[model samples]
Target: MAEDLSAEIGPDRSLLLVDDDEAFVKRLAKAMEKRGFLPETAESVAAGKAIAQSRPPAYAVVDLRLEDGNGLDVVEALRERRPDCRIVVLTGYGAIATAVAAVKIGATDYLSKPADANEVTNALLSRGELLPEPPENPMSADRVRWEHIQRVYEMCDRNVSETARRLNMHRRTLQRILAKRSPK
Candidate 1:
């Protein structure tokens, strides 16, 4: 049966976009506005919480890592304040563990970075439906490995030595890889 998703999400056009990257947030906020949403943006978890608390947005697009703290904090706060708000967690460093954690914490969907406005819009509107399928030509193996390494590095609090040890890789090599920008 087709679920009545609109009823749960309501007709509110308010959207809260929380991400530290100024360019990314700005671009998305503009695109969301073009889609008829009233978008309010914040760069950190604290700011996101404040915005959400002041007047909970009907929807949210949150980055996994924020300057102040994990974006999950914002998700949790929103869930507490507005259980019906649809949230989509965005992350550059995607991982199975984090995605599972996001959904467990009440995010409506978890999408990797480079997700365009249309993708986010669909996620925002299609709560309770099947998740969007992974792209046919997904990230290459090397890119996936780099993303995983980055995830572990961040999980260990950005300690290169610890991450190297955990990955059983040489410290210098890990550093070299970390220094390079992520693969497309």
Candidate 2:
């Protein structure tokens, strides 16, 4: 993280930090404040939405999963209310699915939890180049759907019938989709 980012963004840029974890929010807010941003903390999706709608912060740091709702909803709301504001999604271990969804829905970037202060700061500073335009994700929606199906397939131990049953799809339909996705 560049130490001069605070000077770059100046003291007027307001940052909205939304996470259900109290301790994490406190530490993150303090770190951001030191970098010259005015940090506001919210503990739930509802409160975060309310704060965002009312004040419209210049930037937002959101958690992927909230106690009340998924962070994607918050990202959508923020984008709707503040199109110019940048949003970074925070994810916990093994929540890449949620993080990817958040990015697809308009999160500027996604960072895994236990992220260092420098990591968070770097994410914020890099917003200038990363946001205002959506990032390219090679993982298409169809790819994600197939990946989910593959997980179920593996969990079912390669039992087509069981995998189809678990996914609430007919065996033939699953086979057809998988076949269509397979390389020639």
Candidate 3:
């Protein structure tokens, strides 16, 4: 379901964006502004917290890793200060463990980095809403890792050598990993 933010910010919203990546943050802030959000950028968790405390925003988008501290810390602080605000996390490596940890620590939602403007906006809009039921057992760590490897392999067009090179793994090791994941 889409978020009903009309009551919060009167059809226009303000946001706090926390990330150490200057380029990415700048680009995303501009994109969000075009989407009707006023985005305030912070390069670290401390700065993000300070900004939110001094001028509480309607929502927040935080990166998982920062130069000073983890984004989860910022999310926690935001939740404490503004219980009604939505918090979305961004992860670059897309680790399932980290995503789960973020959610446990008060993040409203999470999206892997390189996400486009639409994806980010949608995640923000749907924040704090119950997600659809996950598949049985869902995906485990090994399954996620295997899927990452498979995606990298396909991006390299199934060239094991290129895939391994891109992933910083030995060709033979990559072969072994893929072979081990093959069903009997």
Where does candidate 3 clash, by residue pair? none
Q: Candidate 2 lDDT, tens digit per residue, 1-184? A: 4254666775558999999999999998888877778899999999999987898888889986688976777888899988877788885632344455667778877887778767776776674554445646566676667768766765675578998999999999998875553221
Candidate 1 local lDDT, 1-184, one digit each (tens) = 2223344345788899999999999999887777777799999999999988889998999998887888999999999999988999998867665777789889989899889988888889884667456878878888789768877886786688999999999999999987665677
Cα error, residue 55 of model 1, in Å, equals 1.0
TM-score of each: 0.72, 0.68, 0.66
- lDDT of the candidates, in the order given: 0.85, 0.76, 0.78
**Which candidate ranks first by lDDT, i.e. highest?**
1
- Worst ten in a row by lDDT for model 2: 91-100
Cand. 1 Cα-lDDT: 0.85
TM-score of 3: 0.66
Taking the tens digit of each residue's C-alpha lDDT, what string does model 3 give over 1-184? 2343345344548899999999999998888877778789999989999987888787899997789967888888888888877788996756555566678777878888778777888777774567666767767677777767867775675588999999999999999986662221
How many residue pairs clash per model? 0, 0, 0
Better of 2 and 3 by lDDT: 3
List ranges where model 1 is wrong by over 4 Å. Answer: 1-10, 134-184
